[model samples]
Target chain A: MKYRGKVVVTLKSGVFDPQGVTIKNALHSLSFESVEEVKTGKFFEVLFDAENDAEAEKLLEAMCHQLLANPIIEDFDFSLEKVK
Target chain B: MKYRGKVVVTLKSGVFDPQGVTIKNALHSLSFESVEEVKTGKFFEVLFDAENDAEAEKLLEAMCHQLLANPIIEDFDFSLEKVK
Candidate 1:
């Protein structure tokens, strides 16, 4: 079966997010004073083939651990659905 | 009132994603042969204060137009929820 996956990878809490900070500062400069904070991360959409749901889930887990996220500093989560 | 927003910014169709291509190739090299394609984007979580839902939505829309996305090459979508 074919599957589609959406994955979100975010830095672990307590990790400094320079990009987010820069964006927040820029927003403030733009007169968006009410903005309090901003945090940024990565999103991935994957299309692949697998034998079944279990296999697809396994593949996604491995892919996230090995490539999509830096397990040491980032946390990743994903959802999958079968594709026609 | 306070609100939390989650934004996703993705390249418009036909735009080349070099990072996604690199990751796809790397996955294939890692023996995840069933992988067919990959696309990557950006995610942002924002915490802010707004007078009401309408104001919060407008603020998020402007932020995306001005800084969160490249209007020419990318599209952005976001969801906002009230925060305590």
Candidate 2:
């Protein structure tokens, strides 16, 4: 079976997010007075072949660990759906 | 009311995505022979106060248009869940 997945890779807590902070500042400048915070991350849409759900999950995990995310500064999570 | 929202910003189709291509090549290098494609985008987690769902959606839309994404090269979509 083929599977489609989305992976969200985010900075772990306490990591400095200059982009997020800049975005927050921009929101404030836009006069959104109640804006609290903004955190930014990466999102990926991947399509690949797998035999079953377990196979897909394992491949996704390896992909996340090896390439999609930087383990030192980022943490990753994902969801998969069978596509045909 | 306060609401939390997630925004996804993606490069429009046909826009050159060097980053995505580079990542795909890396996956191929890892022996993921069946890898088809990889598309990369941005994810944002935002917290802010709004009077209601309509208000929150409106604010989120404006944020995406004005700041979170570039209208020229990217398209953005979002979802909101009321938080407290």
Candidate 3:
């Protein structure tokens, strides 16, 4: 079977987000004073083949752990769906 | 009222994604050969105050247009929810 996955990787809480901070500053300068905070993360769409749902889930988890996220500072979650 | 927004920004179709290509190659090198393709994007969480739903939606749209995405090469979508 073929599957498509959507993964979101975010920095762990307590980690400083410089990019988010910069964005907030930019918004403030643009007169968006009501904006309070911003947090930024990464999104990935992966297409691949797998034998079944269980195998696909295992592979997805391994992929996220090994390459998609930094265990020390980031966390990742993903969803997978069968594709034609 | 306060709202929380989640925004996803992705490259428009036909745009070359060097990062995604790199990730796919890396996965292959790591023996995940079933991987066929990959695409990368940005995710953002924004917290802010707005008078109502309409005001929040308008602000979010402007934020995307003005800073969150590159109009020529990327497209953005978002969801907003009220928060205490």
> What are the per-residue Cα lDDT tens digits for candidate 3 across B1-84?
999999989999999999999999999998999999999999999999999999999999999999999999999989999998
CA-only RMSD, every prediction: 1.0, 1.1, 1.0
Candidate 1 residue lDDT tens string, B1-84: 999999999999999999999999999999999999999999999999999999999999999999999999999989999997
> Against the true structure, candidate 2 has what lDDT?
0.92
- Candidate 2 lDDT, B3-78, residue by residue in tens: 9999989999999988888888999999987788899999999999999899999999998998999999999989
User: lDDT score of model 1?
Assistant: 0.95
Docking category of candidate 3? high
Per lDDT, the best of the predicted structures is 3
Interface DockQ of each model? 0.91, 0.86, 0.90
Residues A17-80 of candidate 2 have per-residue lDDT tens digits of 9999999998999987788989999999898999889999999999999999999999999999
- Per-candidate clashes come to 0, 0, 0
Error of 1 at A56 (Å): 1.3
Clashing pairs in 3: none
lDDT (C-alpha) at residue B82 in model 3: 100
The regions of model 1 sitting more than 4 angstroms off are: none
**DockQ of candidate model 2:** 0.86
Q: What is the interface RMSD of candidate 1, in Å?
A: 0.7
The residue-by-residue lDDT of candidate 3 on A16-43, one tens digit each, is 9999999999999999999999999999
Chain A TM-score (model 1): 0.94
